[model samples]
Target: MKVLITGGAGFIGSHLAIRLLKEGMHPVLIDHLSEELPHARKEYQLKQVFKTGPAAYYNCSFLEREKVSAIMEKEKPHAVVHLGGLAGVIPSLKDPSAYIKTNIDGTNNVLACAAEQNVKHVIFASSSSVYGEQAGVPLSEDMATGRVLSPYAASKAGAEALCHSYRHMYGFQMNILRFFTVYGPWGRPDMAFATFIRKLFHNEPITIYGQGTGRDYTYIDDIVSGILLTLKSKESDVYNLGSGRPVLMSEVVDEIKHHFPNVKLLQKEARIGDVTSTWADVSKARVKLGYDPAVSFKKGFEETVAWAKEHSDLI
Candidate 1:
């Protein structure tokens, strides 16, 4: 099947592209976020992309509804995995208008085109931040999600609403994949993993925020599995794609220390809109989409460290 992946050249999107090619499916990539990455990362991953050779590529933003529609009409793709948007919770708080434009307005365009072009299925990339600051261990799909702490979370909630509207108003299936702290090779530099690694390499102080906030740090491969399995499903549903193992910020720091023992530390107050903690109840995914996350934090961190060392120039 010909699958259209918006943000297909991104960290998760690039990993997805590689998997799709191996599975013998034609995967078309749209990368408006190429410049969003660190310069070194962009250059390195671009070379890797050209080396593997994707099925097709569109170097334009999905915010352009007319152009997005045109691409949808021309490609006539069987499905769309919408991962295009402004990312990061803290960054969203920095410039909410940009987040609204990219995450909300841009997603509406993608969904509209999918509805108009009769795309068979759409698997959207939503954030667990939509759950907001809940006093709980494992957040479930059936819980209320409107109590978001940041503009980014609010925008994802809005996008999920749009997906529901399109799915009901039209007939195409929609599968909302709520990803939690996905990390691995070729990951975004803004994420904690990259920041800590870069700091370690520089022998700089790595800051830990507010009682060592914990998160369910999932691996890239497991998230890709969730996406692929969800694509194969016909029913419209939501699933949490996470490792299901929540770890404290200290634990993550220790995980890094396993590789870099001399890493310095600094303590700081947690930023506003930062959730107290996050742990996903992936039971729905386990039951429905057969989404099983296999990589533990230690294992995943080791793999990421190896890849980071290889591309230390980017750090």
Candidate 2:
């Protein structure tokens, strides 16, 4: 099988590429590399993941509809995993038009191309941000997406709805994976985990928003595992990818303090678009996709800390 991963060079995309390779599938990755990521520059983890398999690279933006279509035509991938988009919530707040253009329009372009080519399956990466600041606890897939806190979340929700429409109209298999607060080594720098690690290592005061919002910090490996399962299942579905346990921001800070014993923190008001807590009810994923989070928060955090220490200069 041949698969096209839109954000192949990215954190989750790179990991997913490797997993597909190990399963004897050829991976074709398209990434704009729009953001300057110091750690991801050399593709260190990406190289390791694809070190032993057949892989192809394309430096292209998803917004370029013609280019995306051309690549789909040339690759003729069996499955399409669309993961590329404007990823940061804060950035989306600052530049909403860009977020909408990329996240929503870019997704439409991918789905349209994949539908045109009759791709067998498409696994899209949605966010838990779609839940917004609901009064409900343990967010389930059935809950209606509420007032989007930011353009980023709105784009994701819009893209998800677009995907459903394509799935229905084109009869294409689609898996809309709603990811919780994913964190671990090879994570995005824009995320709090990476930012905290970098700031603490540099002796810079780390900012604590909402005095530490809680999240279900799903590890990268666990997320990759769930993704691969979805790919192989060859079924269209939506499942939450999370650890099923919410870890508080204060707990994360406390863990850092325990490890470093010298880190400084600067408390601040919780910014807009930031949710107070994110807890996933993984019952559906467990039953439908056999999704099981293998790494606990403690283990995952330790691994992240170790990676941060090794890549201190890069971070």
- Clashing pairs in model 1, backbone N/Cα/C closer than 3 A: none
How many backbone clashes can be found in candidate 2?
A: 0
Taken over the whole model, the C-alpha lDDT of each candidate is 0.87, 0.86
Residue 86 local lDDT, model 2: 75
TM-scores, each model vs. reference = 0.97, 0.95
Model 1 Cα lDDT, one tens digit per residue, 117-154 = 99999989998998989855799997745999999999
Best-matching candidate per lDDT: 1
Question: lDDT per residue, candidate 2, 1-315, as tens digits?
Answer: 899999888888888888888878899999877754654543675576568687988889988889988999999999999988778789888899998888888999999999988898998999999988863389899874557788889999999999999999999899999998788877888788888888887788888888547888899999999988888886788999999998887788879988879988788899988878889999999998888899988889999999889877655
Q: TM-score of the candidate numbered 1? A: 0.97
lDDT value for model 2: 0.86
